[model samples]
Target chain A: MLLALDVMGGDNAPAETCRGALMACDRFPDLEVALVGTGSRVAPLIAEASSSVAKRLHVVNAEEVITMDELPSVAIRNKRKSSLRIAMEMVRSGEAQGCISAGNTGAIVAGGVLVVGRIPGIDRPGLGVPLPAIDRLRMLIDVGATVRSKPLNLVQFALMGGLYMRHVLNVADPKVALLANGEEEIKGDDVIAQARDVLRKGPFTFIGYVEGKDIPVGPADVVVCDGFTGNILLKVMEGLGEAVYALLREEMGQRILPKVGMVFMLPMLKELWTRFDYEQYGGTPLLGVRGAVIKAHGRSKAPAIASALGVARDFVLKRGVELISREITQGGM
Target chain B: MLLALDVMGGDNAPAETCRGALMACDRFPDLEVALVGTGSRVAPLIAEASSSVAKRLHVVNAEEVITMDELPSVAIRNKRKSSLRIAMEMVRSGEAQGCISAGNTGAIVAGGVLVVGRIPGIDRPGLGVPLPAIDRLRMLIDVGATVRSKPLNLVQFALMGGLYMRHVLNVADPKVALLANGEEEIKGDDVIAQARDVLRKGPFTFIGYVEGKDIPVGPADVVVCDGFTGNILLKVMEGLGEAVYALLREEMGQRILPKVGMVFMLPMLKELWTRFDYEQYGGTPLLGVRGAVIKAHGRSKAPAIASALGVARDFVLKRGVELISREITQGGM
Candidate 1:
């Protein structure tokens, strides 16, 4: 199966993207990647790949590029020939089974909705990211896909997220929940209450409202919320993780005994970090869209990009979009 | 100055609360603490203190106790003679300069508003907790005080938080910011945007918008948000810290090398924990109330309760409530 990769996306653009494509091709013999970018930047990188890997890599040269700072809708409308838009178009036209882009998140979400379109019966698409919890991976939905979500949209997120967790991630009898400030029945605002009301009768076991603390504790397999809350929570967790690691390193370096202890603890610390790192988790899937669309992190390196490609390949193979579409249609929102 | 302590509150009550009160009395030679609880439960604990401490510690008999699981408003109204309510009453009647409670947060907010009352010109009271950031402490407000806040209420939170940080925390010019999904001007929902517009024309230097990640980085001295968002953010940070510490301990115990390294790293790690620990920072102040009402953590032990008492003392000494009242009335909220 052919997958499209936006080579002009992310901080480590064409070089890391190219390296990732080759790595993915090497890992999956059945997979082929179409690198989307300007010919000048994309052609030379493909040449560096071995003959066997190079054959599976196809370069789709698009002259325009979208920077990280541009407005999503405006940039998508103006830069139709941009690598991000072209890669999205590949998924739209069925040329690629799935598309992965590490470009601006806003632009990618806009492009995914406007270009790839929404799934039938889905009001708004939700972005789902797998958070590495203590016991299991929990899928948090609408992590900045649609900033302002209605109750119906949140309900759709639960349905779509629940399906993704069950089908793609292979979780048996996935427990879905709404993320709120409190766990009580009357915890969140009107939107959350309404969503919880609908989800109670809908497909799967609705675990009611789970607070932010419950995310790491792995209370629910699929946690749904509006894009605004999810985005803030995601970033806060990331920032805290970075701060903790940095503080530990600084503290260990300043003290004599701890500095000596750091030598023996380095291997264990590295392993623990790898277990918690978002890069190892690959991309966040933009669910409820017409086609499979994966958004790799903007700071993703070669390894992360390769991991995202693997995710895209799995998402396509698992028929995530098809499962979600069926579930939403049958669930009667 | 006299301060009232809710002896029947928190996971470690009576014993911890009495110990903390004695410790506070010993530290502040001029300070007296009224231990409010059942005479049977509190009298013995206070008698265990030294002669000087016992003389300074007064026993106020309270027949009832507010459990953590009870509804805030319902419990506050019904449990009139409860330890929590009696402590709040001491502040209300001017019997004590301030009150410290490590009880149910909802009950505290309800009781503070019901008994101690709101300051004039203040629509809602906000709970401000000092987050230990890398460079300095950033105070986050409206953390589960009034869960659903209007635009005007958010604006009020900013003003109160700013004044508290400037006057009580001693920041020369406090930078106030609204916590939102994004840093962009048009980021959050209508309430946040409206609040930002009003803050722009207000007295303090409005920093516009800061995301959740900015809390740990200390971009703004005071971060204001609706209680729902603030509460989740605070709890999530606490939960993450606990999870990290637990994981590290478990990992260290499993590995022989890391186990030996942990022995050497124990002191440094303990010091680091103390620095980041919320217990060390003391209680969260219920701002915009008529009197100083400090809410300690529900799981607070003796040391945390002692630290909370210190915070209560400082809040009363700095005239936190009067300053907030003057600012709100003059600032035209």
Candidate 2:
């Protein structure tokens, strides 16, 4: 499969993106990676890879890079040769099966929608990220994508999240639920109440309304909500996880006794901490688009970028975009 | 000051309630404690407390106790002589300075609204609970009270939450913020966007739209949002906190080495854990009510009920209701 990688993406980019490409080439020798960015800037990092792995990598020379501060529309419009835009174009023009980026999210999203476009029946595309729950991780969608949404938008999110879990995570017939204040159908606002009705009547094992606490309990497979609530929940969870780890570290470092305890429990703590870490999960996928567009965090390192590339490859191999489009069009009307 | 205490409230119920009342009586000698419940079932617990430091405790005759499973309205309607109703009536008739219950939250809210009524000029009343943040606790209001709210309701929540911080927590001109998905003015839905405009022009020390991560930093004194988002955020925080604590406890209990270390740091760990304990802060107050009505946790113990009563006393003494009513009427127009 031919996958386009935006080398001028993320905080650690060109280096991290280059390393990830090389790593992907090593793991999947049959896979072809087209590194999209200024070839000179990306060459040093790409050269660090083994000759055999480097042989599988191709350079698509794009002169411009989208900065984090630039407005998404302006960046996408002005920098036609930007790595993100170029990579997106590769997928759109059938030069590559999928595209992956760890750059400014707004810019990547804009590029994906403008270049790849949305599926036929989908109203708005959504960003889905895996959250660490008790026993397993749950998928939370519309995380900062589609700022304003209707009941139909939420319905599409549930369908997409369900399909993603089945194809990517290999969870069959995932339990889909609407995120609300209460678990009752009668609860929540007009928007949520209407969404619940529509979702309940639709396909994919509808589980009705799931409360916020249920998100971490692994009770439901696909937890759906508007972008506003979903994004806030995602960020809050991220902040809380970081804060707890920091607090624990500071407290453990204070005294010799606690330090000893930390040393003894370091392995177990690390394993448990891994559950809340998002880096291990790679990046969020912008679902409901006609083509695969994986969005990694802007500060992602080599491992994260490589993971994102792997995710994009999986989507391409499994024909995820086609299946999601079919599901939406079939289930929606 | 006479305070009515529901002896048969919370998961621990009569035992914890009776003990909390006795503790309050001992702490505040002039404060009169009226234990409201069926004298037959409550006599044993009250007698037990009387043997302690609560010889002067008063027991009001009440036959029925609302169960968690019962519907709020049905429980209120059927159990006319229930402990919850009697306790609320005590405050409404001025026989008691305040009412405290660690019972069914919906029933408590229903009883508060039905009995005490909304304070003048208040559009809708809300519940404010202090959440454990990174450094300090922040107050989150409208947690499941009014799920479908307007722009004015959000503005009112800001006013109520601000007054709560100023009077209850003693923070002057507490920075108030409208919780949204982003910091931008154009970020949220129409209701929130309109609320932002209203708050900017109102009496609050209005800090613009705050993201979810901002809650933990305690950047704003008051964090306001609609009940749906507020409730979801509150529950998510609770679940996350519990998960972290459980993980820490498991790690601490792993082996003999960590167990030995745990012994040395037990005291310090206890102090740190207590700092984030919600029970220490007691119940959530139903703000914008004519009289103070505190809703304690269903699993509240003697100490939690006592703390809640103390909160109620402070609310009454500070004349928070009158001040909030005045602010709403003046600022709203």
Candidate 3:
């Protein structure tokens, strides 16, 4: 599978991106990678890798990089030679099976939708992020793309999320849930109520309405909602995680014995911390699209970028795009 | 100030409710308390209190109690003699300044709106809860009352939440923020964009759009949104708090030294725990109403009921209803 990487995308661009691509080459020997960025900027980092690994990496020169603050529509229109734009175009032209970018989310989302386009029957493509649970991770879709959605949109999200879990995470018949105010079928607004009705009658194993608290409990494999609510919930969890860690650190500093005990508990603490870390799980896939488009965080380091590349490669190998398109066309609400 | 309490409401009704009312009487000498519930259930608990304190409590007989499973609209219509309905009627009939209940939230909200009516010029009333932040408690409105709302409704929530923060929390020129997916003005859905436009030109110190992360950081005095997003955010925060506390308790039990350290840290831990405890905050006030109607948790204990009464008394004494009414009449939004 040929995967396009935006080498000049994230905060730690060129170096981390190049290093991550090299790492991916080592991990998956059969995978071909095209590093889409300025060749001069990425060559030094590529040189650090083994000669054989460097030989495996192909450089496609692109001059501009989209910044975090740039307007997404304008950036895509003006920066034709930008790495993020070019990478997405490669997938559109069939040069690459999938594309990965750790850059401006707006630009990435815009490029994925407007440039690469959505699947034939899909209403809107959604971004799915895996949330950490006690036993396993829960995939939350439409995290920040397509804010205003109809009941059919939510049903599509559930279908796509379930497919992603089945193919990628290897969870068959992933229990799908509609994020609502309560767990009752009669609860929630008109959108949720209608979605619940449609989902129950449509496809997949509908688990009825799941409350917001259930997201972390892992009762359901795929939780579906509009991008607005999903994005807000995702950020709230992230903020809460940061706040808890800060409070724990503060409490550990109040006494001498507790401080010593914290040192002893470092390994256990590290294990606990990894459960909430997003980088370990890699990039979020923009599902329900004609081709695979993965978005990594802007602050992602080498490990995160490498994980993103692996995710893109796996999506291509698993034929995620084709499966989702087929599912939507055959049984979509 | 006179406060009416539903003694037979909540999970620990009559017992904890009776004790909490007596505790409130002891704490504030000028406060008058009226316990409304079935005489058979509450008489014994009231008799358990000190004779002098018990003498100050007035017992009003209510025939029925609303169960958690009963629909709020149906409960209000059928259970006319219930504690929740009677207590709210007391406030409506001018027999009490404010009503407090730890009964069914849907019933409380339904009765509060139907019986007490909305404040003049207000569109829809909302449930407002104070979230415990790092530096201070931030007020979030429309927690779960009205699910479907327009941009105008959000503007009203901002006005009501701002007034509540200023009068109740004593914050001057309360900074108001629209809870959105992103901080950018151009970001979010159509409703959020319209809310931003309205808020930018309306009264109160608008702080622009605030992300979900800012809710717990206490960046704004008032965070406004439709009930759907607000309710989800509230429940997610509660779930995270419970999850963190549970993890901490388990960690404290892992070793002897850590257990010993936990003993010393118990007081501080308790203090931190209290900050996130919703029971301490008593009830969510139904803002944009003619008279104050407080809705406590359906699973509330007696202490929570008593605290709700205290909140009611404070709202009445401060003339919060009239102040907000006048503010709206004077074009607060």
Candidate 4:
């Protein structure tokens, strides 16, 4: 499968992105990548690769680059020759099976909708992030793809999220839940309540409402909500993880016994971190779009970018976009 | 200070509730408590207290008990003699300076509004929870008190929450932040955007928008949002904490060296738990009510109950309700 990678968007930019692309090529034998970036920067990295690896990796020159702070609409409109836009265009024109970018989330989401376009029956494309739950991965949809979502939008998110979990994550009859403050039928606001009504009778396996804690606890396979709530939930978890690490380090400093103990605890701590590693999962997929589009985390380095490329490859190979569109059309909820 | 304790509600019930009242009376020299519950169950627990504690603790018979599963509106209207309602009535009648309950949150919120009543000029009462921040305590308001809130309600939450931080928590000119999906001025939904406009012009130290991570990371003293979002954020944190604990325990079991290390690391881990302990802070105050009403966690034990009682005592002593009313009337944003 062929994939387009934006090599000059994220914090670590060309170097990490190029290195990640090479690493992904080594991992996926059949995978071919088009490194979309400036010729001067990307050519040397492509030239340095081993003969077999170099054969799979191609440099597609694009002079301009989209900065992180640029407005999504303005950047997409003005920077036509930008690597992000060029990579997206490759997917739109069917030059590549999928596209991966560690760029501005807003720009990626905008490009997913404006350039690649949404699926036929989908109202708004939702971004689905796979969070590592207790036993398996749980998909949280609309994590900042579309805010100010209506009841219909939430229903769409539920359907799309459920499909992603089932097809991409290989969960049979994925249990879908609407994210709310409480698990009761009468718990959430008007929007959530209305969505719950439709979901109870909708196509997917609706397991009812779930609270925030359910994300980490792994009650449901697909947790659906509006972009605003989902985004907040995602960020809070990230922030809490950082805070816990800081607090633990501070506590470790106060006692000499624990400091000595820390030497033996290093392996266990490494295993714990690996169990909850976001880098290993790669990128969050912008679901409901016509083409396979994966938005990697902005701060992602080589390992994370490579993992994201793997995700994009899996998405394309699994035919996620087609399945979601067909399901939404047939379900007709 | 005279306070009413609802001993009939919560998981631990009369035993923990009565035990907590006695503990609070001992801690606060000027404090007196009226234990509200069934005489049969509550009387025995109170009798076990020391002579001085017994002298200060009074039994107020409340024959009915509100179950956690009951509808808020139905429970408040029908179970008028319920311990939750009786405690609220005590505040309403000026018989107690404030009220504390480790009961159904919906019932507590309903009772605070229906029985204790909303403060004059207050659109809706919000639940303000004191979270342990990096440096000091940060108050998160509207955890579940008022859902389907308007922009006006958020503005009111800011004012009341700010007053709460300044008076009860004792932070001078407390910085207030509106919780949203992003920190950008143009980030949140219509209601938040409108609230942002009012907050920038209205009284208080409006610190623009804050994402979910700010709760643990400590950027603002008072974080205001609709009850729906706030409740989810709060529950997510609780869920995440539990998940982390479980994950770490699992990781520890996998290695023998780490198991030995865990013995010495217990103290550091204990300190970390204490630092993030919600029970030590006691109950969440129901702000914008006519009188002080603190809602303890439903699963609270004796120590948590005692902490909540301490919070209620502080709220009454600090004249939180009166100050909030006065500020809302004068500010009139």
Name the candidate that leads on DockQ: 4
Q: Write the per-residue lDDT of candidate 2 for residues A120-184, one digit (tens) a residue.
A: 88888899987767678789998878876788888889888988898888997789998888775
Off by over 4 Å in 2: A73-79, B50-56, B73-79, B247-257
Backbone clash tally (model 4) = 0
Write model 1 residue lDDT over B285-331, tens digit each, in one string. 99888888999888888888888899888888888888877887787
Could you give candidate 4's per-residue lDDT for residues B52-115 as a string of tens digits? 8889998899889999899987899899899889889988999988999988999999998899
Off by over 4 Å in 1: none
lDDT of 3 by residue, A1-333 (tens): 789999999899888888889888889887778999998987777877776677778899998888888988889879999999999899999999999999988888889887888899888888999777755888998898878789888888988999999998898778999888877656788888888887886567889888787887747899999999988898888777777667767876775655665666566567777887778887899988778799987788888888899888888889998898788778844
Q: What is the lDDT of residue B98 in candidate 1?
A: 90
Ranking by DockQ: 4, 1, 2, 3
Error in Å for residue A291 of model 2:
1.4
What DockQ does candidate 1 have relative to the true complex?
A: 0.68
Better of 1 and 2 by DockQ: 1
lDDT score for candidate 3 against the true structure: 0.83
Indicate whether candidate 2 or candidate 3 has the larger TM-score: 3
DockQ of each: 0.68, 0.57, 0.53, 0.76
lDDT of 1: 0.87
Please report, in order, the local distance difference test score of every candidate based on alpha carbons.
0.87, 0.83, 0.83, 0.87
Q: Model 4, range A32-106, lDDT digits (tens) per residue?
A: 999999989988876778878889988899989988778887798789999999999999999998899999888
